[model samples]
Target: MHVGVLGAGIVGLATAWQLSRRGFQVSVVDRAEPGSGASGGNGAQLSYSYVQPLADPSIWKQLPKLLLSPSSPLKLRPQLDPLQWRWGLAFLAACNARTSRQTTAQLLTLAAESRAAFEAMLAALEPDCDFSATGKLVLYGSASSLEAAGRQLELQRAMGSEQRLVTPEECIAIEPALAAYRRQIAGAIHTPSECAADCLKLCVALEGALRARGVRFLLDCEVQGFDRHHGRDGRVRAVLTSAGDLEADAFVMALGTASHRLGRRLGAYLPVYPLKGYSITVDVDPASEGAPHVSVTDSARKVVFARIGSRLRVAGMAELVGHDASIPATRIETLAAATRAVFPQASRMAALHPWTGMRPATPTGVPIIGRLPRAPRNMLFNTGHGALGFTLAFGSAERVAAQLAS
Candidate 1:
């Protein structure tokens, strides 16, 4: 059985690997190189414990302030598009406590599953992804936010997460680099079991493994449309690409934000929207200066910092401004300033490599992973992972493979 997987990002590559493992010939199609999308240079934190939805009740209260403020973590540029409005309204509707809690529970389960799957892959492949069990420190800037986060630790514990609330002093004790901002830090939640790894490295390793396993990679191939077969179970007979039409026994749509456009053409209501985000990698002198060895999350700034070898990866912010991949100068400046305020001597910040990408997000913030309706009986989808694309990829691939097998 030959399966054609669309989108050569991390999710698509992982799905192809899973399908190949299941005795299926896999071919991945993409317009560019693998990991060139959101999978490239992400925050690098395997956040199995911090699987909370973005549209919580607190966001409703903070929406106006976040939009109006110049230095807010989240930004939304409203447009005249009905698609954006519809997705915005759906997100607002999901801001209730009940819905937020339900989404968190579901995400926690998936996060745990993803962590296990990632560990298994690391053990089997021994890939050089800068895999490090450095733990994670989520620093809060306010007492209220710290209190709320501390309270949430109980819920995480109940859901099989290992974390503990720590004081600002203890936070610095865990990662002495944070001593630079001791006065600014209020409290923190330290998850000892969490890990950080280079996402792009992992993607490259997966792509190489797939090639070694005889999976075909069709790069620079733009998928235009699909040819359907008329039967009791209507399926995609072939996928029309710029190169040519390629037929497969099964198809998977792992296209990130582009999945929304494709799903709409197929008559499916996919509420995935692009959330633009930025990141800057800075070289750090780990020996002379105090660079944080553990991954750190700034609760106030919504930014995360991780030490991927000698380079420090800083990423954050969510801008709802459509599919534009242009990097905003102000946003990048803000991220650099915020990260420096926390760790002054961690990075030189002079030669920073900035990058921006569109993250495919759903209203509830959980990815849409399943087979499509009966019309595309042989088709499956695994996208809309937002900021957790790398964190959720392998587990999602396993789910898709199981669905196709069934």
Candidate 2:
């Protein structure tokens, strides 16, 4: 079978790899290089314990404060667009206790499967991407926040996560560099089974591995639109691109934020919106203290710190209702400030490289990974992952492959 996988992000590449391994002749298409989107610049943490949805029942009360505070983790720039308002309403509707629990349960299942799939991929490829199982630390600066996190940790533990609470001293023992902040540190939760990896290096290695496996890559080719050729049996035949037409027995739409636009063209209405996120990578100076080996997420600041070799990356903050990808100075400053607060030993702030990427967010914080409702029988979708693309890519690809084979 000839399969055309649209988009070259982590999800799309993983799908292509799985399909090719299944003996399908796969052709992957993307306008940019592989993993150049949110997959490249994200915090690189494979947090299996982070299954909670972004909109909790209590989040509605905190929304006004989060919007008013400049330094707060969540911020929404008011827009007059009706789409934004509709999405907001939908988001609020999903923030109830029942929906939150259901969403978290579904995420836990996907994340666990994803972790296993990632381990299998690593064992097969042996890619040198600095992959580590050092676990993730969630830190809190205030006692109240720590108390709330403790409750959340209990919920995660109930969901089969191997997470535990740690004292300030234990936190420092795990990562001694955090000793300086002992006075300010209240507590933390350590998920020892979680992992981290150099995402960019992994993407590059996967691209090379796919090529070695004879998977065709059509990079720098923009997909203008899809050409629906209905056969006598009323089945779609081919996809028309700017380069040329390609005949495919099957097709998968894994185009992250662009899925909405492409789905619209294909007569499918996907509720995927662009949630912009920013990150900064600081170059570690040889003379200064080295970066933290473990990944860390600050609950209060809503930022994550991931050590990728000699570079320390800090990423967070969700800006909804914007198509712009420009790096805002204020956002960068907030990330830098959070990084400094967490790791005071890091220096050379001016040497930081800042970037922003759009997350294809669904109002319910769950990815849409199923066959299109009214599209051709063989066409599928694996998009709207938002913030969990890298975390859930492998598992999603496996599911899509299974669906196609079945």
Candidate 3:
């Protein structure tokens, strides 16, 4: 069987790889180069044990700051588009203890599977992408929130996650670079099994490896629509692209934010929406300075810090501003400033590689994986991963390929 995977980000590349491994002739299609989307400059933390949904009951109380504060990490620019309003309402509806915990449970299972799958691939491919199993520390600013996180951690622990709440001094012991910022931390949840890697480099490596394994890549080929057959169980025979109609036996859509528009064309209502995010990569001296070897997440600031090779990948902020991909100077500045405040000696603040991308997010934070009843039988989707694209890609890819195989 021949399979066509849409989008060349981490998700698409992983899907192509899994299909190829399953003895299917695979081809990947993307408008631009691989990892040019959110995969390029994401926070490099592979949050396996710390899979928290964005839509929590706490968002209800933080609504005022999120709406009024200029320095708030979460921004919502209400557009005239009805999709925005609809998504917002759905997001608000999902902000409950029951929904958040349900989503978290599913994500934890997928994350564990992803960690194993990625490690197996790592041993097989032996690809160098600055991968590290350094633990993750999510620092909370207030004791009440820390207590709340502890309660959540208990639930996660019930779901086979190994994590513990730690004091500021203990966090410093884990990552000495966090000593400077220790005063701001009230407490933290430490996950020792967490890992980090350069996502962009990993994507490039996967693309090359898949190509070597006879998986074709249709780069620079813009997918216009799908060429489908008739009936409820109709199969999408091929993808109508700028290059030509690339025929395949099965099709999987992993087109991130663009997934929604293209899905609508196939009569599939994908709940994927773009949450614009900013990231700044800065050159760092790990040995000479206090650059962290471990990944850190500031719960209060909503920013993350990870050392990817000699560069510090600092990313955060979630903005609901449509499909605008332009990197605003102020947004980059805010990210840089946050990095400076958190890890002053980590990197040179002036020399920052600023990037902005549309992170495809579902309201509930649980990715839409596998085939939908309303969609074609041979058609599958791996969209709405939100910020956890790199974290969940392999597991989701495995699931998608299983559907095709069965």
Steric clash pairs (candidate 3): none
Which 10-residue span in candidate 2 carries the lowest summed lDDT? 229-238
lDDT of each: 0.87, 0.83, 0.90
Give lDDT tens digits, candidate 1, residues 1-406.
Answer: 8899999898998898788888888999998999999889688888888776788888878988766877777888788878788999999999988898788888899888888888888888999888889899998989899887866777777888889989989998899999889998888999988888888998899999989999999999998989888876668899889999989998999999999888876668788999888999998965546789989999888999998988899999988888788887898898889877988888767777999988899998989998766338787899999998988888899999888888
- lDDT for model 1 comes to 0.87
lDDT of 2 by residue, 1-406 (tens): 8889998998998898788778888999888899898888888888887766886887888888766876667777778866667777888899888888788888889998888888889988999787888888888889888887777777778989888989989988887767766787789898877788878788889899999999988888887777666774334466677778767888898988888888877678778888889999887666866467778887878888887777888999888846888887999998888778778886577676889999888888889997876666677899988888889999899999889888
lDDT of 3 by residue, 110-143 (tens): 9988988888889988877899888899999999
**Error of model 1, residue 361, in angstroms:** 0.3
TM-score of each: 0.98, 0.95, 0.98
Candidate 2 local distance difference test against the native = 0.83
Q: Which stretches of candidate 2 lie over 4 Å from their true place?
A: 231-234
Better of 1 and 3 by lDDT: 3
List candidate 1 segments past 4 Å from native: none
